[model samples]
Target chain A: MNEALTLLSFGEHGWGDTIAIGALVTVSLALASLPFGLALGFLLALAKKSAEPSLKLAANIYTTIFRGLPELLTLFLVYFGVQIGFQKALKLIGIETYFEVNSFVAGMFALSFVFSSYASEAFLSAFRGIPQGQFEGGQALGLSRKQTMTFIILPQLVRLALPALGNLWLILLKETALVSTIGLADLMREAGIAARVTKEAFLFFGVACLIYLILAIISSTGLARLERWSKRGDTAR
Target chain B: MTVVSSDTALPPPPPLPRRWTKARILGHVLMALWIVSGASLLFYLVTNINSPFVQKYWPDYVDGFLVTLQIVSVSLLIGALLSLPIAAARASRWKVLSAPAYAYVYFFRGTPLLAQTFLVYYGAGGFRTELEAIGLWTFFREAWYCVIFTFSLNTSAYQAEILRGAILNVPKGQWEGAAALGLSQPVTFFKVILPQALMVALRPYGNEIILMIKGSAIASIVTVFDLMGETRRAYSRTYDFQAYIWAAVIYLMMVETLRRVWDRLEMRLTRHLKR
Candidate 1:
């Protein structure tokens, strides 16, 4: 027990600080991807619901491919495939310079792709939950379409979409661990280093799991509270 | 009955006005840009055959594909079996039975599969001597076995939840009707309720199976030569992007095929319910 404590201590001999930084990376990755992902997801939802058949079909195909593919594969594709493609494009444009995509950027791009695909589904359902009359009512107010979306529809959409999106956030938090494979010093990777060096694989891995569990618990409770707050206006309509 | 049809039929409802909505305009611009840029991407991938990449790694990719299939299928089979009792316990009236079941599900569902896998695979090393003494080291020592073990446990939780929900949704009347018929509880569950519950679970089961297929890629990380593992080897050898793209194509095809097959299976199973 004392050995375990000393091994995890924050000093030169200990690995606590490294693991703490990893946890921060994990949280930051998830947080940083949120706005971009949400924006893309909203656009995807719009495309899927659009009157244009081709647009809808394209959106469907995009979501299907993104969601069905493994996150690991997606990460690798962004890491390797995008780099190669980008280089080739640059070459074609008459510029030649050796470049590499950062692992963090690749991870973010892949996570956003996956996140948006799932989020689009939630957004689509939320859009459905609103009555058509809501849109018509917006028009009745002589509000421009964009104005109506910003002032009226979006607030309601956020409420209806909150539970599903909140669940996705939990999924995303865990998914950040995948970035560790690409060499991001995330929680999993830090523990991995600690385990390898100390030969206490169980202790370190167990600690990692505990940290993830705590984060998941905290997120769930926060989301539950947010759900209630979002539904404050909801009643026996 | 209406002889004035041709002349009086309200002047073919004045052709609806083209709104030229902002969204439509944006969609058009996006379409044009994609047609120029994204279309080229699709064209290149579909037509540009990297023969050397394919010829060199095709066999390896095939082997990896089989391994992936074997992992997903074997683990899912075991997971389904494990989930049966778990689902029962979760549905049980006894707090003792249900509470542990709930905790098991929550822990597995809460954490990432990769970490659970690391815990099982490397954590086994921490207990090498104990495992060896118990004659279980041989099993735990194999990366393949560890992966299957972790996957089975992870998937079992999801399967259990699906089953518990399905069983609960079987309706109060079925249980009452079975009891009124003098059918014992176990017999009723086995003969009547289970079949109905299974039908309700069919779609979710299909989804779980697809998820397992996608997830099996992680098995490669532990040195199991699964599809992703094979792709990684190919990319390392050539530094070619086509290897990963091809793997993605294969995965997409597998998922699409299963989706269609599942749809057909669902329709066939529920044929009686159709009008």
Candidate 2:
């Protein structure tokens, strides 16, 4: 017991601090990607709904390609392919500056790209679910198109989209672990390093799994509360 | 009044002038640029495939594809079998039977599969002594078995939930009718409920298969020479970025094919309900 405690203790020799920091990195990665993904998803949903054939096709292709590919492959493409492509493009444009696509950035790009595809689907369905009368009613009340969207449409869309978005959030949190494959010092990577160093793979990995479960449980509870809050108006109706 | 009608006829609506709006023009330009970039990227990939390195490594990728198929099929078969009892337990009236099953599903679904894989693969090393004593050390030590073990367990949780949902989705009327016929509980479930529940489950089962195909890519990290593993190997040897693209294409093909087949299967299974 004493030895195990020493192994997990935070100090110059122990990995407790490192693993904690890794957990923080994991959280930040998820948070950083969430808004970017949501914005892209909103845009994609709009594009898909647009009258223009080209715009709709573009959005369709984007979602299909991203959604069809595995997340790890996407990460590799961004981490290696995009970095090289960017540098090459810069050179052609007479720029001598060097740019590196770090694992965190690559992971963020890949995950957000994946998240946006699914989110767009969720948003599209939610948009379809809104009653046509709501829009007509807003117009009948003399509300402009923009006003109708903001006051009448967006709120209801949020309520409709919340559950699917919550599921995506949970998935995004889990996907942060994939960044470890690209050498990001996220929770899994930190656990791996510690395990290798201490020759205690079971203990470190067990700890890592526990940390992930705790995070998952906390997020799920929060999501449930959010769901209830979003649906509060339903009970009154 | 009749003479005034011709002159007041709105002048043929001025031919509905074809003025371009700023937003319309911008949308068109953005769409064109997107298409151009996408086409050029594909063009580059197609033209670059003539490399000698790609030719030499093509066989390795084919072998890796087979390995990936093998892993996914085996694990899914085992997972489907294991999910049956667990799903039963999850839906049982007895709390003693249900709680542990619920916990298993919750934990496995809540956390990432990668973490679970690591725990099983690396963590099993700690149990080398006990595993050896049970004559299972050889299986536990190999990365292949570790991946299969982890994947089967992980997928069982998901499959169990799918099964439970399908079972619950059966109409209450069906159960009542079965009971009215004086059928035994097990008989009602097996004869009446199970077939209909299975029909409902077909789509989700197909979805699970697709997810497993994608998830199995993680096995490459554990040194399983799956498709992704071979991609990494090829990339290291030739420094060819296109190697990853090739693997992605293959995965995309497999997923798309599976999706279409699954859709057809669902339609066939549920055809009676359709008009």
Q: Pick the candidate with the highest lDDT.
A: 1
Full-model lDDT for every candidate: 0.91, 0.90
Write model 2 residue lDDT over A206-225, tens digit each, in one string. Answer: 89988988998899899999
Across B1-275, the per-residue lDDT of candidate 2 in tens digits comes to 45667667675555665457654675677778877987987897788778786689889999999999999999999999999999999999999999999999988898889999999999999899999999999999999999999999999999999999999999999999999999999999999999999999998899889889988889989999999999999998887788888898899999999999889988987999999
lDDT of 1 by residue, A48-153 (tens): 8889766776688789889889999999888877788788999999999777888788999999999999999999999999899989999999999899899889
For all predictions in the order shown, the interface RMSD in Å is 1.7, 1.7
Query: Model 2 chain B — which ten-residue stretch has the worst lDDT?
Result: B10-19
* TM-score between candidate 2 chain A and the true chain A: 0.93
Instruction: List the DockQ of the predictions in order.
Output: 0.65, 0.62
Per-residue alpha-carbon lDDT of candidate 1 for residues B59-94, written as tens digits (9 for 90 to 100): 999999999999999999999999999998998999
How displaced is residue B212 in candidate 1, in Å?
0.9
Q: Lowest-scoring 10 consecutive residues by lDDT in candidate 1 chain B?
A: B41-50
Measured by TM-score, the strongest candidate is 1
Query: Which whole-number lDDT from 0 to 100 does residue A147 have in model 1?
Result: 91
